[model samples]
Target: MLAIINDDLAGAGRPESIFISWLLWQPRGVDLASEALKEVQKLARYEKVDPDIARLKALFASLAGSDRSMH
Candidate 1:
């Protein structure tokens, strides 16, 4: 499942590529889903501002709010 998403992300390009990078670089034992959520939050907070990424941040924020497993 994750491999499929990673392939789709690689094909799609840009911000998704960033997500793939994050997914690959996470420390051992970190939860992949939670780390992905944190990566989305960090992208909006620390990276150069991108309107498209800001929109993605909004969506991720909503998902994180509802998904207690991410916390």
Candidate 2:
């Protein structure tokens, strides 16, 4: 099961796919918060207006800025 997921991530290239890949990596000790933060900025710069995306960007910004030790 994990092997299949790894294989998919290894081949994914779409922006959303890459984001999902980063999300999956986060739980495995990978520090994806920075990447997520950058992605949020990219979305905002491009004028993406989806409320959900905006909310996600805000969440990512908060996560990226917050001290991890507190969590």
Candidate 3:
């Protein structure tokens, strides 16, 4: 998790790609990114922002550790 977050914050595109690769390799770790995406999207709207845009932004922020609260 930390590694992925770090990669994202570093603006490395590989983490996102690598995550999918990890899924292909392990095939069972629960690719939690999807759920994370949904939850963060909800948070965005709950915070009174546009849900779709906020969701994407938050997901990117998440991948990049731009969001400080994911931990």
Candidate 4:
């Protein structure tokens, strides 16, 4: 499943890549947070609005916060 998402991510555009990153993060949690964050940053660079982007941002933030608390 993750390998499939990574393959899709490699060919996806900014928005689609961001969505794919979120999919990559779902089962993996903090391990994939940086990948998702990179995608989010790429999307932010375009100054575009995506209905699902906010959810991705929230998910990354939530994961980051949890990851930090673990250390």
Q: What's every prediction's RMSD, in angstroms?
A: 7.7, 9.6, 9.9, 8.9
- Name the best candidate (by TM-score): 2
Global lDDT of each candidate: 0.49, 0.50, 0.46, 0.46
- Per-residue CA lDDT of candidate 4, range 1-71, in tens? 11222345455544346555657556644456565456445434332365454444555445455422111
Per-residue lDDT of model 3, residues 1-71, tens digit only: 21223346554444345344434554466555664554445455443343433444455457544575432
Q: At residue 43, what lDDT does model 2 achieve? A: 52
**Cα lDDT tens digits for candidate 2, 1-71:** 01112345455543345445557666665577676566556656533555444444565565578532111
Task: Give per-candidate clash totals.
Answer: 0, 0, 2, 0
lDDT of 1: 0.49
**The CA-based lDDT of model 2 is what?**
0.50
Query: Which candidate would rank higher by TM-score, 2 or 3?
Result: 2
Give the clash total for candidate 1. Answer: 0
Query: Which has the better lDDT: candidate 2, or candidate 3?
Result: 2
Candidate 4: give the clashing pairs. Answer: none
List TM-scores for all candidates, in order: 0.41, 0.43, 0.28, 0.33
Best by lDDT: 2
Tens-digit lDDT track for model 1 on 21-70? 54567699976656557755565563345555654444455545533222
Q: Candidate 1: deviation at residue 4, Å?
A: 23
